[model samples]
Target: MHWRVPLSWLAVLCLARLQPSQAELGGAMCHKLGLRGECEVQQDCMCLCFHVTADNSTLVDAAYFGELGYELILFTPLVHFYHSRGILRSTVGPAGSAPFYRFSPHHREVDVQRHYCLGPYSNPSPHMYRREWNFDAWIPPNLHEQYKGQGQAILGDGKPLMIVHNKYNQEWGAAPTNFISISTLIALFSMLKDRYRIVYIRPDPRQNLPGFGADHNHAEDFDDHEHLRKHHPKVLLFQDILQQQRNGTRPDLNYNELQLMLHADSERFVSVLGGNSVIASYFAGVNIIYAVKGSELTGHGLKDREFDLVYPRLGPNGKGTILTVSTTQHLLQAAANEFLQQQGDTEAGRTVLEASHRTHKPHRS
Candidate 1:
């Protein structure tokens, strides 16, 4: 595992210590990473091209190229995971530092003019850590039409849909620190369960979906599945939805594909940090991301962080609203305010929770 840099000042210090011309900095940094003559460094501070590993990293990096209207050739273990999100040009490669061609899209493995080795972070490259994120060009395909309303059937209700995703695996340590608590969910659910058809999602690698796997090998520290089923019976679980879809006509739809279709049809999402949150931000909507700790909360400073400036541009119009919260209280407050339109101590807009199973055609992408 990569060493977790807990302090944000340390990153700032490293940047401050770097003293070189933009061109020299690029060349020096490249050579320092043992890419001396292999990669061509551009005159500008940013590299002309690069490759990234990991699911979220690949999405952000590929989207950067997509925004520039440049075709990106991705080599990822989860080929369909990226492909389902509208990344049509991707190839399968073994995970981790394995032997593979970096530039095979043009069949040019030798004498490549531009390409850089990107660090395994969500951002495209270490130098472009402050780069603006873009998923405006990655509008998900209209699979509802292709699959003949498989996503529409999943909506299962006429109420406005809200996608909720949470994670409870070990992150940065032995304990799971950043996750949406059950109590918080109950509180948020009580407020909006009547107004929205909540779809709770938590992907498990045990499902054995092709080109997809767990966030990491870390064991799950907590399970909210049974709790939600027992208490919030009206809330629709994604696994259940998948099983229903499997028994239907379009059983070929992969996990990622179904998720993309469902998300594209909805306008409200609630997710925790990690790849779940990243994926939720892709669709044009209001994404409430609860992240207590991580590089996302620390790096790039508080005023100009990626969550504030970059993540919002993930939508097609570059106008998606992403509200980041650090605590469960903040999450509940934001939900009540944004989703419920209730502020501080005001119980206005509270409605009785009612189940809605009436199927309707969801909005097309």
Candidate 2:
């Protein structure tokens, strides 16, 4: 018996042959969308491709894919951190990779999981801030063990350490917001200085990594360093530690590597928004993040909330408690409540900081 092929079936086969491969189709789609690179989707996973600046990127994005059990082929800047991680199948970038800001994948890449910059589409939660995104795979606790105690000799001073991170960048708006002010630092230091060995961290833009290029922050000059040096003599400055390490015979560690080492020793952190807060959330501790405005409060582009949802997952098994505040008053209050009230209460002849619990500051635009 001879089987006859239908004309419709033949037409379908011809159409399938004529259609571009998924990678080529993705490349064409990316070009049409004005993206520099392309995206390729395979069975149950996708190869997210982009060569954008690292500042516009987030390790959270990479982890999101990892949690979803996707194999990643990242071709972005600052690929050193992504190496050896189980999630990334492969990565292509220089250790000294300098990111040019002309191309941003937020608008271009559409096939991958995106929770940010999703406005202009018909999604219910345009920014997707209403829901939580997992960051468990971003920096596992095991990975942190390697860097732990490396900064202990440098930062250990017999007292429990608290890492304080501050960034002065105009990311959200033209004026400087989402930063811990010098006056606030003075108040915070005076409150907890004697009880805890406070380590202040603010990366200098001028200090470039040995192999990796200097991470850009569009920093505005502030005199907090001078203030800390003059007033708080015992408070360890991260820059000073870097300078000391650089002068001494030690391994050439980049800013992120040094941060990982120092932060591993710390269980508590006080940080401003942006990458500073993200990195601080890695350790299993209470990360008090201060942000006056951003996607955390107002959502990425739409409206819901991002901080309370995804911030905790940055730590191991979502163990970290991320206390987010907007005002300096609330920041002071959280510090007093978490650190002073709990730890420094019984310290003999220690000055107590009174942070009012009555006036709760809500997130603002």
Candidate 3:
């Protein structure tokens, strides 16, 4: 829902870590958020501490603490939001807030732990203290209304629907992040289109590719659009992604059309180290199809199987088999079909999709 962030926010986030005056409480800005008391940056039993200055504003020093042994996972303009793949903007905060500082959650579950930090860091948010609330992982708290369109996508009347999440095209060092090149995704889609309508989801052309140290190419540098157009003319671009960025601005969390689009559409989710993978991993019933490839691919655990929801977990019925498939060519189509059959199309409004006897693409083949 928001537009291009002003340069100021971008500038502050440049380092994402800075030395704060240890003596001062929350900064002036922090005071405005209501953290009046002296706010010292100290590690909680589980939370990362933020420095409060004279103004009472909180300061995030993720890198410094990370060096001291705290694990820091920072994503930026290159990381996609869990709700969609077309747009790439990264932050662990609920609403794509900038320069987030996370402490190891009281619970390892990210979906449950994030609510503690909602709103201003200065506010009386749950994140200020640690407590265990007994609730299953349902959905992330404070989701903007737009992220609610998932039900519509589930309604193909049992026809197969697939969401292929192509994370980043960039490589981490010499290692690949289980990346399926756009051309390959196009090929897979071609193989699947006859049986199931497939959606190829990836970062929008306007977003930055991962700039590990030097991949910071201009937005125009991305060939996602070019490749999709060139090879897979029939593959859809997960509509939400291109539509929002057509005029030059990437989609914002404030009005996440991506969340709505993915929710309404995606069923069998496939991606490696992408945000969409994160969504599928935690949200119950959606089948998982991934194998780790990047050394740092687990960077934010965005695409890793290890990361999962916390408090609100799906009942046993929500559990689906996490398939293991190799990148070998001969195995892909058959494996994908088997995976889909294991977790068939979810009924509209149901969190768990029922397993169907439907064999993807068999009739056509």
Candidate 4:
């Protein structure tokens, strides 16, 4: 007969994959999530697409489009001035992850992946906080459903809207993604309740409560319901984590769901962000994060390249103002003063800035 392995041994084997040696975790963290993949620099490639701006305006090609195409080695008979496929993505804009490669199936022979945008584009990373291009096939299948049924939209009703998200995954850091303290968020949202409307992007749908897998069979072990409802009054609660399991309906934003006007109407967004927020706020045209005092580029899961790629205008924690950074309060106030000041909502923002600058003197790293 055959012998069966103990459950304990199985558990150990499963956990081993997560604990890639210090060398693996220490090196180049993938920009995708900074939790997996060993690639440090993020595989870089270039493509020429028929680009369209967010307002349906066509954008002029950067420098020499034909030269760039030839450099990319595309032997094409019809290289149009307007990249019809368009500038597909950026760290800051509706286009989503600018670096995540994509290829048009119809033009599979053309190896270069396609990219574009649907709105006012933020510059890619260091250039600006967001970028814009045009869309080819970026539309989601659930467009109508999300438009009709997507849970909530934290819009600005004469208030500065701020979206904050914190993810928890067992693969990050020494333990799972635990460094993002919910209490810290509560404190943050509480501080600006009067001036800002706070929205909390839930723990990623892919994530599960402690001790529970994707199946969430042991969701009972998690008991943060009262804590969330009671203490998190200042912040908007989208849904209850512990409740989704008991109801059998997984309450979280689906990939398709994000495309339907998710942040299109937002004023500002703040988070200990990742690819998801970067793209969503790109859609909204606003993504800002509070650089926690003394933390390098926000925290453990962030890569400097990713930070630079999305927001070069702001620096990590307190390194300098633009290149090298300053305080989130100082930097953000400047951005708010400049970017949204013309939008006719400056007085309140300035007040928040002054308050934040005085109280949250982001310690220079």
Candidate 5:
């Protein structure tokens, strides 16, 4: 019986030895430093990029790259890693001992055909890009809920709203670029939050507005002159008339309930335009009078006609308030700079403008 027990123990020991340990399996899958034998045996291993910053040594985490199924290709002392998936591609190279990888996270592999440049310049204009528009159409429901929580008033009469003129739809809907324009729009909205009540104009279900059109001309014709006279007597006649007529009735009610009512009711009174002439004329009135740039009109490719009238010279710190006064490209550059300055990086504003002029392909006026 004792010999049989010893034989049973020996069999259990043999089975335990045959099965791999958890540490052994994990080690085979992931690279661990100082495990030369295991690393040399594996078909693929992790490469560590180290750097010294402020007298402290730091290691670049290559685990993210490894999980994406990339093999580190060594070229002498320098290493390069690349991955390709359909039309998207990415490459990671030694960036001063801290390896930096360019990745298109949507696809598993890199796209060799499409080369991407850095900065806001390499980005597409909001009016020129197409696929981006589709993506912009979808906003996470949670974000909408959050916006509502913040008292974001939509549709004055409690009607369901459709986005007629959102900065996201204006810039990203037509362009294949990062969210620089949209970011600027957010910053501007932030700045105006205390002074104005901003609302996105929802499309009327009965009214089908075209996705893209020329300019709007008769925007002012839609203003509620009666309402304006009663509440906002100081409101300009032309301004009240124009907002009533624009297709995407996204109007800023500058913290005045009377002005809001005048514009809100005016939206119900006017017929919307879809052509370039209409848009250009509408913008000519708005931009010329108030020095305010509407994202909706601007996204339709209208520069600030008010530039010559409002911003005759540079404002404080060589800053020009009329950034959206020129071509779409120049407007984008200026907007980007303005955004950076708002973020407390004043130097980045000029850098972005210079980079835009040098790198971005100019849009023909």
Candidate 6:
């Protein structure tokens, strides 16, 4: 559901009187409009709100009104709005309880399930809100003709499923899947929906940035799809790694190491770009699986050695087709151990080894 800042003249009057100062007015307006904290606020105070009720690009045009003195409010009615405005079957309730509403399917004997409730104090109460207003009420027959004529997209057979993976890269020993993983998922789902009579699978916890390094790099790569496709072939993978790295707060692996990893895995491995060398893999296509740590890659070895062994090959198209795991903790620990061992601090090396060992364990849900 989306909330629209009330745009009535009364609302403007309230705003003008309640907040005389520009700063206070801007702050209050933003808060009431449910805007993100980073939304650009020009000195002149122009603002536009967008609602992606249908197409993803529906909000693009609305975003360009930049006079800095106007407010744009976008409204998106609920999906069930049309389905909840008809004659509903009713049920009597216990004494003091609100009356309930139901709507059974045309040919069914049993009463329909109750999906919405109407309290005594609810607006348009009792009969209309409870007995007569069914949340699943059938669409009006006249409107059905119009709807069918509109040629709306139809959902193919089967249910939509979403897959969400967390800390996906830490297991692969390289980096995380980039925006390619997500964009690929979206593209593949769209295609599959057209042919297989299958519903779309929406994957979640998809990395947007691996960490600070990735965050910085993403700023550089923004909107330069051509540069990203050429210079950072696995740009999406780079974003995932950078996002994770920033989240983990790891400080090692500066820009040079990040660039090297990006270059190193351009064709096959999905490097998280910046941050540690941890990599994660995600399966594409139907019925995909996500690989967690310990299920694969047991026993100890150098960070690079382990990474080379675990990072899987991309498909013939130089794009990921299956899932993998990745991480940088081991590399960091290994580096610390090597430094301590070089200084002849055997105890410190041992301590680092133990700590690294513990770090590799999977976090419990």
Which digits, one per residue and each the tens of the lDDT, describe model 4 over residues 211-308?
A: 21131111122223346668766666434423443355545433223323334344455544333333343333344444333223543444343345
lDDT (CA) for every model shown?
0.51, 0.53, 0.35, 0.33, 0.25, 0.25
- For all candidates, the clash counts are 0, 0, 32, 35, 29, 39
What TM-score does prediction 6 earn? 0.17
Q: Best to worst by TM-score, what's the order?
A: 2, 1, 3, 4, 5, 6
Off by over 4 Å in 3: 1-160, 169-176, 204-224, 239-255, 294-321, 324-335, 339-365
TM-score, candidate 4, is 0.39
lDDT value, candidate 3, whole model: 0.35
lDDT for 229 (candidate 6): 45
TM-score of 2: 0.65
Cα lDDT of model 5 by residue, 8-76, tens digit = 432332223222453354355433432211111112322222222333322221222221101111111
Local accuracy of candidate 2 as per-residue lDDT tens digits, 64-118: 1221101111112112223323122232112321121112222121233211122
The total number of steric clashes, by the backbone 3 Å criterion, in model 2 comes to 0
Error at 312, model 2, angstroms: 1.0
Give the winner by lDDT.
2
lDDT digits (tens) for residues 1-365 of candidate 3 = 22343335433432133246531333443343332323332221112223334453333321111110011112111121211221121122222222121211211111111211111221112121223222211223222123334435323344455666665544433434555665556555654565565566655434422211111211123466577767766555654444544434543322233433454344465655433444443333344444455322243434322323221122123343344333424224433444433445222212212222223321110
Error of model 6, residue 314, in angstroms: 40
lDDT of 6 by residue, 1-365 (tens): 22322335313312232324543544554444443221222232222222233322212000111110001000000111212322111212111111001121111112111112212111121111122222221121111112221111211123221222222222234444432244433332232222222211111223222111111111212233334345434223333444455456544433222322232222122222211212222111211222223322332323222223222221211123332223333432433332345446576556556655746532111
